[model samples]
Target: MDPKKIFTTILIWLPSVIITLFFIPNALDKILHSSEMNKIVSNNAILIITGIFLLIATALFLYNRTIVIGTILLASYMTLIVFIHMYKGKSYEVAILIVMATIFAAYIRSPFTFQQKRNY
Candidate 1:
């Protein structure tokens, strides 16, 4: 077994879990309650698409399958989220984006990514 990838998997899952449990909910709340968010999502199907993606991403991450795909989806949604916040004049969006990127990078580099590989 490649110990490095195993470590990487842990790193990836850590954020995946946090974002799924914490950040995602907060984001969804804003997207749901704020009139501004409703407009962004109401007119643009892209936002809704990404919203659905968050659910898919969480599911994939939880099952530890198709994680890279899940991460890619998450990255896209978060990127959009950051920009949305910035457009709304939220100053902390960039910081959140950076932290999320860092966590994602760790997962992308984790050893556990090689789920099909066996210990030899």
Candidate 2:
């Protein structure tokens, strides 16, 4: 593989790995009724649902065939999280990182065609 491509892959996958590590454990916490997670989402049902969505979104993100859709899903989820944090006056710093990571990954996967060199 080209060095540039390797670097690009790393850039894409690094964020993905970080996100997976974060969300999987968080989802598990919600599923297992961890007190820490419960503080953020009081209702078990809502927490479980959100966890499931996170898992599915993460799965979609990890698979190359669904990268675009996964990025979209992740972005949407992050946006919701940002708004929730803003509403509650909580720091949304992590959410912002995830959002930027998703956007960067998506761009690396499919950059703008207009920015590419064209053949006559």
Candidate 3:
């Protein structure tokens, strides 16, 4: 593979992997009612629903065809988190960082890049 393609794949896949890993454990905590999530959300129903959404979003992100949708879903979720954190008078830096990183990766991996069309 071309070095550029390899780099782009790394940029996309690395963050995707990291984001998925980040969300999975949190999702599990919510579903399993673990202490990690209990400190944040108290409602079981909300936790379960959020956890399920995270799993689905991660699945969508990992699959090439659904990556765009997955990015949107995950980004939206993260954005919501940012607001929630701010509302609770907590730092939202992590959520904001993830959202920005995900958007950057999505741009880099976008199928509609000008170079692809020009190469055809």
lDDT of each residue in 1-120, candidate 2, tens digit only = 799999977876776787778778877777776445635667778888878887888788778778778778888988988998999999999899889887786566556621668899
By descending TM-score, how would the candidates be arranged?
A: 3, 2, 1
- Candidate 1 structure quality by residue, lDDT tens digits, 7-26: 86687566656667754674
Backbone N/Cα/C clashes per model: 6, 0, 0
Off by over 4 Å in 1: 1-14, 23-39, 43-50, 98-102, 105-109, 112-120
| Model 3, span 1-120: residue lDDT tens | 699988867876776677778878978877887444545767778778888988898888777788788889989999989998999999999889999887666666665731344554
Q: Which candidate has the highest TM-score of all?
A: 3
Task: Name the TM-score of candidate 3.
Answer: 0.77
lDDT of 3 at 51: 84
Error of 1 at 77 (Å): 0.4
Q: Is 2 or 3 the stronger prediction by TM-score?
A: 3
lDDT scores of the candidates, listed in order: 0.61, 0.78, 0.79
On lDDT, the candidate that comes out on top is 3
Ranking by lDDT: 3, 2, 1
Estimate the overall C-alpha local distance difference test score of candidate 3. 0.79
What local lDDT score does residue 89 receive in model 2, on the 0 to 100 scale? 99
The alpha-carbon deviation from the true structure for residue 60 of candidate 1, after best TM-score superposition, in angstroms, is 1.6
Please state the error at residue 4 of candidate 1 in Å.
17
